[model samples]
Target: MRKDIHDYDLSRHNTFGIHATCRRYIEFSDEADLIGILASLTEADHPLFVVGGGSNILLTADYPGTVLHSAIRGIEPMPYPTSADDILVRVGSGEVWDDFVATAVSHGWYGAENLSFIPGEIGASAVQNIGAYGVEAKDIIYKVEAVEIATGSCITIPAANIGYAYRYSRFKDEWRGRYVVTHVTYRLHRRFTPHTAYGNIAAELQRLGIATPTAAQLRDVIISIRRDKLPDPAVEGNAGSFFMNPIISRAQYESLLATWPVMPHYDVDADRVKIPAGWLIEQCGWKGKSLGKAGVHSRQALVLVNRGGATGADIIHLSDTIRADVRTRFDIDIHPEVNIL
Candidate 1:
């Protein structure tokens, strides 16, 4: 572990290129260093925040406390063949998500292929419950190993207990930073089971002339489609998706459906349905809308981008405007998917 602060620039660290200074910055190599650093901070003095890949966060203010960069990296492949056709493999949390998908496809391991090109480390994936196309991280996640910050102890939770949903987790909603994820174990497959059920996935597959696609080919398609749609955080300082697809009750959905026949929605569970926030944003004329450097991406209305040099407050205000507009137009509230600091 090393404690460095003098030359650190947060603009490059965060996906949203906002320039904010941290009071203190520390990097740890393993769990031992993590414990030491946490132990060093006093209750009121230490506002210990975990930063994993810095993809799904917006730095809205100058941090007054310490920032711990999660660098715990190692992938342990545990293969289990549950018959002649099934194969499962577990991955590490600190590993790069896209790299993990690439390796899985190379080895013919097949669960995370659909989530290719998604940014951030594998550790942060569970918190955001990252999903796209016709697949989600929760679908293949078997278990997650994490260390509780309060008691300085480690624990493992099953996929069922993680409270998996469309871009949500117990870690994000209820337990925020109660635990720092150490490793993630996913149960992948061997056979080629292409999940091209999503709206454009099938069309893209047909265009590529691939009837029976391999795991690698699926990763390629997902990466290509995402590159075309979502702006790369490296180039355009922005998180992939700003707001979550709002989930509403069946009654509310039915009412909306009755009013606007073309309103898009997906059944989340038996009682609730998820409505696309993008539809609401596009309806309100937010697509490509600009206010100084802070504006909503032209291609994707759900994504709020930093065009040049925008303040955190500028972005926050834009978000508020979009939220207010969506509510006024659709009578549905929109919640940010990215964590606001």
Candidate 2:
């Protein structure tokens, strides 16, 4: 089925909770419905924006074009060789991402446990390549099934063709607004291999006195860690991790390290390193600081929160201020991870 509304209120559609609306909002629950809706679209719906779960966007103003949301839902296991150690499962794009991860762990499926509580839907997971702990969606994704917005033809794109990178995919670049994802197939392990070294997972596990943790145990640890750090969107109107950690040259890292002495970094390659944007933001004194109605999240500097009734422009202003500070102080440029419109 499909639901089409004109001049739709989008405050609930976006996680930022901005008071905004679009010229049109079209939601479809199945492929046929999506195809039919697309076929009937007029020139009024020329420009389109696709959103999933609304956890990764910041709406700045009333949109002048159509906004498409997927309501398609399902999860089905695909048959594979009985002796194979890994299993393949097909999931609807509209399925809640964390719910899928929970189900996977419940059924003894591995590889997704480390990504336990990240927000957004399965479709957006592929689009954003959402990651947590040490696992990215691309690590388990096998193929992506989508509909070409222009041709209205179904396309099954192999994961190898997605061009996955840190917090990005082709769906966000050259393929932006070109396709609507319908389903994603993931290759999951039947055997559990724990990824506990990244972040504080190992420490959390050790604190719980679990040397060899189960999938469920690991998932719980990740959930607990995230809950302690990030705010709930329902209670606080904000998108998580407002900025992407900037990657810089090794020489640049050394120069900054000499000045700060306590700078933390991760190796991206021999010549490049990824610096934590949150650390930089904190050093600039933005953490827990408010600019107008927008503020940096008190616990995690990477997040920007709606202190109350903040407009999209307010959030942008806060982000801009922080970006300028970081640039001036560290000479490292940070970019937003959230999609802003």
Candidate 3:
């Protein structure tokens, strides 16, 4: 249930296709194995990093510490539902995220359909608070089960205490290196309530002649839209949505709007507005452009690609160039969504 290797090749671990290695690599398939491995660790494993699916990270150099990955996998529906309208399902951290969405949709479960096709794993979903369309993982997450890395004690934390925010969770910040997520429980609705108002979902449905879409149809529409915009990591090396959309004050947004007159924006609240980072990048003339081996994806300017043999540094360079330009032109700073390590 556990495999430990020294001086491990990590090229296949990350989606970026960056050639890198680590001091050690450990994969555990169950909670007991994880506890045993943690108990046996020495100072050699000083700085440990946990990765899942490796879809949202950019490895900048060879890691000098141990890399932990979860191989534990399963999906189980909890018996004795407390609510007739909803059901709770527990999913292993190592399970592919999209696969879980697919299963949920196939079984007539709602809530997760809006997040269909987003990459990464269930564990990463809880950590990243992954969202797409209009729904975030926090909206459906009932609880998170994890093991404290220091004490190897299993603990279940409810969603309310996780401090969920926009593309963020306590796990990514103050709780970093404190625990490794093993499973996530989600509350799904039995009655299908499709959220098609956000983005182009409704428009796409209308174009396809679907007035009332089933969960499967909605998922298909989202997948089609994503495929049209984002490049496959398998075919081209890239982290999806390299930048997080910048949220600015309403006054700032209004001032910028006066000059551009047609700038796209989303109202975050009464005081703030979310500006699309892709639109800003494209306006700065980085879309479909290249800096060495790293380039901006033509369709989705938010994505930075490894054109062929791009290194992590090459991607960083390209990102830096775009960030600088965006700052100079708009007086706004855009940050990367992908973790750089």
Candidate 4:
């Protein structure tokens, strides 16, 4: 357990690079350390917020509560039963997500290669149901290990019990701030089942003159595609996608399609259709536009970048303006994927 700091700066902790401070910040390096910290804070009055990787949150302002971070790190491949064709790997919550994906690809582990370069840590993956291309975290997650915040008891829950959906999980809902995730177990296949149907992975690979893409090739292509579309947080402060693609009824999509003939959409189900939020923002003429130091990314309108010295409010204002315009112009409501703190 690290000594707590008072008024700790969080500019570097979050990907948006917001200059917010917390009243108290504590970091635990391992499960034992985390248990100790939780036990110590049980009688304390300040509210607790646990964060990993800091990639999915937008700090709106200085926090008045205690902030918790887990630094526990490791990835261990567990033995698989002879009857099963899959392998189970247990990972610490603090391990970098991309690094784990890279390791899996190198060792011929499938399923996660399509999720190649998505940011955040292993712990946040299940919480956010982080997905890319055609794959989501929920698909491979076998179980999650966490410590209850209230009682400091460790519990292992099956992935099915987490109530996962597109970009959502129970961790973000009823269980929010109630547990500190310690480890995640993923079931991956020994065979590489390439998924290039979503986005431009297939076309991009073809453009690169590759007729058949291996697991590593697919991973590399996905990383390249993301790099071209999304700004690096190190260079320009931004989350990958600021808005969740709005899902509407099929009737509503048909109504909009009649007005905008070139609109792109996908069927979420028999009655629901999903439209790209980026295309909607572009249609509203907000792409590459800026308000103060916040701007829509030139390459991808779904990303809102910090044009240096941008505060949380600046980004929020820009998002609000875009949301209102989208609703007024298309009668669709686009919500944010980034968690606003």
Candidate topping lDDT: 3
Which pairs clash in model 2? none
TM-score per model over all chains? 0.93, 0.98, 0.98, 0.97
Tens digits of lDDT, candidate 1, 1-341: 47646335667668998899787777766677677767776775467677877888899888877777767777667756466455555566667898888888898778788889988998888788899876899998888888788877878899999898878899987888688887888887777688888757778889999988878777788888888888987688898888988988989888877778898887778999888898889999999998888999988898999998998888999999999999998889999988899
Per-residue accuracy of model 3 over 1-341 as CA lDDT, tens digit each: 47789999988888888999999999999899889988988997879999999999999999999999998899898742578889888999999999999999999878999998898999999999998887999999999999999999999999999999888999999999999999999999889989998889999999999999999999999999999999999889988989998999999999998787888888889999989999999999999999989999999999999888889999999999999999999999999999899
Which residue runs of candidate 3 sit more than 4 Å off their true CA positions? 79-81
The Cα local distance difference test for each model comes to: 0.82, 0.91, 0.92, 0.90
lDDT of 4 by residue, 206-316 (tens): 899988889999999999999999999999999889998889999998898889989988788999988999999999999999999999999999999999999999999
Question: In candidate 2, how many Å is residue 28 off?
Answer: 0.8
In candidate 3, the residue pairs with backbone N, CA or C atoms under 3 Å apart (3 or more residues apart, or in different chains) clash, namely none
Off by over 4 Å in 4: 1-3, 42-45
Q: Tens digit of lDDT per residue, candidate 2, span 74-105?
A: 98987555648889989999999999999999
lDDT of 2 at 116: 88
lDDT of 2 at 86: 88
- Model 4 RMSD, rounded to 1 decimal: 1.3
Which 10 consecutive positions of candidate 4 have the poorest summed lDDT? Answer: 39-48
Q: Alpha carbon lDDT of residue 45, candidate 1?
A: 43
